[model samples]
Target: MRILFFDTKTYDKESFEKQTGNYPAIEIDYLKTDLTPKTATLAKGYDAVCAFVSSDVGSDTMDALHEAGVKLVLMRCAGFNNVDLEKAAAYGIKVMRVPGYSPEAVAEHAMALALTANRRIHKAYVKVRENDFSLGGLMGMNFYQKTAGIVGTGKIGAAMAKICRGFGMKVIAYDVYQNPELADFVEYVTLDELLASSDLISLHCPLMDNTYHLINRETIAKMKDGVILVNTSRGGLVKTDDLIEGIRARKFFGVGLDVYEEETKNVFEDRSDEILEHSTTARLLSFPNVMITSHQGFFTEEALAAICKTTLDNAVAFEKGERNGNEVEERQ
Candidate 1:
């Protein structure tokens, strides 16, 4: 099988190339360009096309891939919100994704962001570099006895809950389906209750219609004053404008974001010399209490290795024409 990988980076090529021995029959090619409608024809004669988080797999791209005789669409990441599933179904293309690839990596990054923001570690480092460490604005509260609200109870969210429990904090969660494994330690509550009571809120849910902009102005109003918020999930899960307003009103004590809405054209590229066109991102950066990462929550070594292996496994399963849990099918 021949697979063309889009939006290839140094780490992606390194990790995928390191695992070539696992799939000897497969020939993989990497391209630095993204998979858009104009670039979809580049996959001609390839058996499948591999994509990343920022690749555009819309209807036009799907049609182009179908015309190119590509049968499989393999996403190396967990979320599928970038792809149009109905269009893929109509084009007779099978979609597969690597879900739950080291959820601990993301959960751990979420904690890192929370800690860095709360303790102002980044600022302290800058201050100490100039020999001005007087500990004037570094008073951070303890996590013990604080209430942490988790937005999802999936593998990543559950992992975050465990970490919060270890810190001696009260853990409450809200999910459409309750995770029985976490029932003993986590108290499943309504979204309103979680929003009203949590001192710290972390989001780990998938991006869908119901979850798109889940944290908007209305929901932000419901949250407690000076609440710390962390988002390691999809960018669309939180409305950036509302978040900016919340920060302007002094609503959040600290905000850590691994993802943002307008990151597609900015995240993987080097635009440090140019001005950021997105005003919302610029405004968020202006706040001293906010910390934003370039969507590197799943950039750990273990997660990359697992993603490479699962992507190969998913491709192998698709080649066999076997039904697997990774396949995203059309709803009847």
Candidate 2:
């Protein structure tokens, strides 16, 4: 079996070799290029294709991979929003993904972003570099005794709630699927209740039909003034225009984003000196109260290892025609 890995990063190599070595019969080829229609031609004669986030898999790319005799696509990340599932199904491409590799990695990054934005840490680091030690306009709120409403109580949301509880904050959560583990201290409340009562509203849901642009005008109107919002999940979950307006009106005191809605063609790579043409992103970066990270919630060493091991395992299992739980999600 010949397995091809696209968009391979430096951190993924060690774990991939370690995991794939268990199945010595399979040969793996790793590449840093992403899987697009043009790049899909590189998968010729491969039994399976392994990919990371930001790799596009639309109908054209799927057709190309199918023509190359690739039968399976293994996604290292949880969100398959980047892949065209209907096209994959039409082309007889079975998709598998590592659903919940390490929620703690993302939940921890959400806290890091929120705290950095709330306390002006990013600005402080810049000032210290310039030898400015004054603390003018650096005031921030006390996170303790505040209320945090987590929109999705999945493993990641539950982890965030636990951290908030550790800081002496009340934790309220809302999810379409209820988690019995969080029934002790967290209340599964309505979205309206969460918006109105929460001092900090953090989103941890997947990007889906109902969740796309869930935080638009109507929902933002329900939120309290000076509410801080953080999105470490998918970028499509929040409306960029609404978020910008919320910041302008001072309704959204701060925003910590690990994902931007239009970051697919750009981010996770580099554009340091190039002029950023994305208007919404440019405006978002211009705000003093907002912070944006390049969808790096899963960049930790531990998560990278887990992602590769699971992804390679998914490919090996599929090749053996074994039942793989990672491919269990219902395709769109």
Candidate 3:
């Protein structure tokens, strides 16, 4: 089978190329262009197309891909909010994703973000680079004995809870479906309780209609003053405008975001030379306590390799006419 990969980066190409040896029957091609309605016709000769988080797989793109003879859509990342699942199902196009490709990588990155933001590591690094290492604005609080709230108790959230526990933090979590294994240690509480009590909060939930803008002005008001917020989850989980307001009111001590609302425009690309037209994104960059990463929570070597392997495995499953749990279904 011929599989085309869209919205691919150098790291994606390197990882996917290295894993091609494991699936000898499949031929892979990398395309830096993102999958959109205009570019969907490029999948004409390929049996399947592999996409990433930012690729557009809406109704028009799905229709185009179906016309192009693309039978399968393999998403290398976990979130599929960008895809039009009902449209794909209607077109008889199978969609599969790497759902648990190194949850630890994301969990660890959340911890890194939390720690970096809390201690003002970025500012300290800049100061030291200029041989001026005075600890004036570098004061930070200890995580020990502090309350850490996890918004979701999925694989990634559970991993983050474990790390917070390791730091001697009082961990509380809120999830619709709580993990039984963590019940003994991580207390499952209501969203209001979690928000009210937590000194540090991390979001690890998926983006959906119900979860969109989970953190907004009202929710921010519920959180403790001077809270440290970390989001390694989907971008839409937090409302950027509300967050900006929160920052202006001095509601947060630090904010670390690996993903943001307008991420599709600039996350994976090198657009530093161009003028940033998005005012919110530009304003976000001006805050001293805010740190934004280029949606790289899952950029670890282990995660990239796993994503490639699972992507190939999904394609192999498609060739055999077999359905796996990774297949996405329209939400009822």
Candidate 4:
């Protein structure tokens, strides 16, 4: 099969090529550019295209791929937020994504973020590095008995819920599509209830129209005073400006973010030496309460292997003329 892997870098080649296997000597074309509409035209002769979380698969891009005779979209990442699912389906170009490849990887990272932020570990380490550690402004609250509101009850959310519960924290969750298994373990409540009650609100939902800016100014207003907010999900899910305002107002005690809005060419990859020049992010980083981590929730070795296996399995599945249910079916 002729395949085009877009928005790629040298780092991913080793893991992906190694897992691709030698079956039929798959003809692979690597593109440094993301799978945008302009770039999609370059996939003219390819049978399929593999895209990552940030690769553009909007309406124009999907139409371009279809026009280029691309039949399938094999997404390397589990989240299908970037894809135009309905457009792909209408164009007879099916799409599939890794469903739950590395839930533990992301969940563990969320746990780590929560722990570090709550314990002020980052601040303490920076102080120690500067040889200015006097244990001042470093006192932190214990995790035990804290109310944790977990949004989304999927594999990752459930895993995080379990961990927080194990820490003797009361777990409250809010999910549009309810999962009874997870609901049985934690208190499931309305969005307002969760926001108003939780001491720590962790986001694990995908980014879609409904979920975009889910955590905005109004919702932040409902949250408990000095609530801790943690997000390892899509960047757009939380309104960064509103979050920053919340931080300034002292509405939120601490923030542990692995993602942020306006992260098109930023997240998952590092361009550290480049000047960010984004005021919101610059201001956010200046805050003592905010802890930002480059999106590395899925950076574990196990997660990478799982992502590769699922990605290649998707290619093989398309080759066999079968459907992968995890793929996006519709959007609207």
Full-model lDDT for every candidate: 0.93, 0.86, 0.93, 0.85
Using all chains and alpha carbons, the TM-scores for the candidates as numbered come to 0.98, 0.96, 0.98, 0.94
| Residues 102-176, model 4: lDDT tens digits | 888898899888888878889999999999969887777878988999999898998899888889999999997
Q: Where does candidate 2 stray beyond 4 Å?
A: 328-332
Candidate 3 collision pairs: none
Superposed Cα deviation of residue 72, candidate 2 (Å) = 0.5
Q: Is candidate 1 or candidate 2 better by lDDT?
A: 1
What's the lDDT for residue 308 in model 2?
72
Q: Model 3 over residues 64-97: C-alpha lDDT tens digits?
A: 9999999899998899999999999898899999
| Tens-place lDDT digits, model 2, residues 1-332 | 78888887666767778777677877888898889999999999888888866888778898899899999998889988878888777777889999888899999999998898889788888888999999974678999999999999998999999988998999998998888888888988999999999999999998988999999988999999988899999999999898888889888778899997888866567877788775678899898888899898878878877887787678778877887677733444
Judge candidate 1 against the unseen true structure and give its global Cα lDDT, from 0 to 1.
0.93
| Pick by lDDT: 2 or 4, better one | 2
**Which residue runs of candidate 3 sit more than 4 Å off their true CA positions?**
none
Determine which window of 10 residues in candidate 2 has minimal summed lDDT: 323-332
Better of 1 and 4 by lDDT: 1
Error of 4 at 17 (Å): 2.1
